[model samples]
Target: MEKLKMHTPDLAEENYKKLAALFPNAVTETIDDDGNVIRAIDKDVLMQEINTKVVDDGQERYQFTWPDKRKAVILANQPIAKTLRFEKEKSVGKDGTPGGIDSQNIYIEGDNLDALKLLQETYLGKVKMIYIDPPYNTGNDFIYEDDFSQSVADYTNNSGQTDEVGNRLVQNSDNNGRFHTDWLNMIYPRIRLAKDLLSNYGMIFISINEIEVTNLVKACDEIFGNDCHVATFVWKNKYGPGAFTRGVASLHEYVVCYAKHYPNSIEAELSEEEQKKYCKRDNKFEKRVAI
Candidate 1:
């Protein structure tokens, strides 16, 4: 067998050279992900060299990216043969009519990948709405496990689902250089599968933190198509000032919404029970309820 060697020159070196050519001070030796001192460019310093205070328009050249982004796309497209095994013990009713599933409300707790694959046969293009609250990729907080080299069958067959101590979740730490890459790999494929489960009039809402928001939106755009992007909602969930932050007071997180078609409209009607709680009446048709 042939051995792999350092075939391609370090991309960082070329990047530093370009930055150094423009701003010499910005180029300096820095410890990389591997802890080896290497020539690298200071992004903030390099940006300072640019003359524009304004960013370019999206149609021209803006993009969201990370290392091995194409791999994420490939992972999304790969078909998984895994199936969701039934959990008889955890069902609401032993007869398997849990939550009146005959009417389409049911719960199955298992590996999301396997569950999603199983869902394809029954729920493909049949779901009306989807809301996902994935693990927020904060270093040491939590992580999604994705072994890029392993096939779906390998995942189902392997016993490495849990760590040494039996923890199912993985940790994406700050020092683990593939932080963003690992996250992108995990989320992209799941979102892609979930998108397929949506009907023509369906929509998806994803709650995410700032760290992966940009990358997530780009991945969603690629999977759901750019025209499907509906809105990015900023939710001020805090009642008061939040925990200590670097510069700005923290009070908001985000929900990114996407639709199966372009220019979709959201319609909401208040129920009679909810409408009865209205305490005030206004002159502007005093009857419109707040969604």
Candidate 2:
């Protein structure tokens, strides 16, 4: 009897097929994790194709490419050895009823990547909204580890000092050679994972700043598709530092929203005060009225 293949669809595999269709020479045979022969892409050929200018128009069109991009995609798809454990004692509830401020909500404390992976079995395609305030890649903000294969002690000493609870996060400044690459690798996998969690009608919102807004949008365009991009809202960031931008004070942060599947119509929910004003018309005009 043959064994079962029960897992999420390999996006990279599908991408390989598509690439093969366009440029058959780019397809190659490779050994996978299980030592079985599998389809893979010839990266050199693919790069050649990417750099190729169109014959019809003498113009070049290429995507935002960076170091560790391929690794980031692989990381999102790779299975984690970690599992989530429930703390029954620490859980918020009445004795056994699973009660709290809201019974349906669960608060998992762990690395965000680990948490996203663990939730896949239960919450895949079930989530309606995903809002993430990722590290902004500012001078003082946290940047993720480049090589997890390195020793923890070496990483701790080199990257950053231990915080109160002892979680280490390196400060990512523009001065570092891998400043953008480090931050990109950190958030890329998480964004791909987030896209998987969204329902067909769901949406994902990302909070970003001047430092990394363009990169974040480019990543999302690849992950969620350009057609799914909704909007970007400029919000006044409350009392943030102005040292980064030099003389001109920085006041706003961007909230970028993208839909899994675009809806035909969107309706905004009204507050109590707003709802109260939607009564009868007064003199051919809708006027505010207290309920």
Highest-TM-score candidate: 2
Instruction: After superposing candidate 1 on the true structure, give the runs of residues whose Cα lies further than 4 Å from its correct spot.
Output: 1-63, 94-104, 148-168, 242-247, 276-291
Cα distance off (Å), candidate 1, residue 81: 3.5
Determine which window of 10 residues in candidate 2 has minimal summed lDDT: 94-103
Q: In model 2, where do residues sit more than 4 Å from their true spots?
A: 1-61, 94-102, 160-168, 238-246, 269-273, 278-291
The TM-score of candidate 1 is 0.63
Top candidate by lDDT: 2
> lDDT tens digits, residues 187-265, model 2?
9999988888899999999999999999999989998888888888899976856557677788899999999987766
- The TM-score of candidate 2 is 0.72
> Clashing pairs in model 2?
none
- Would you give me the overall lDDT of model 2? 0.79
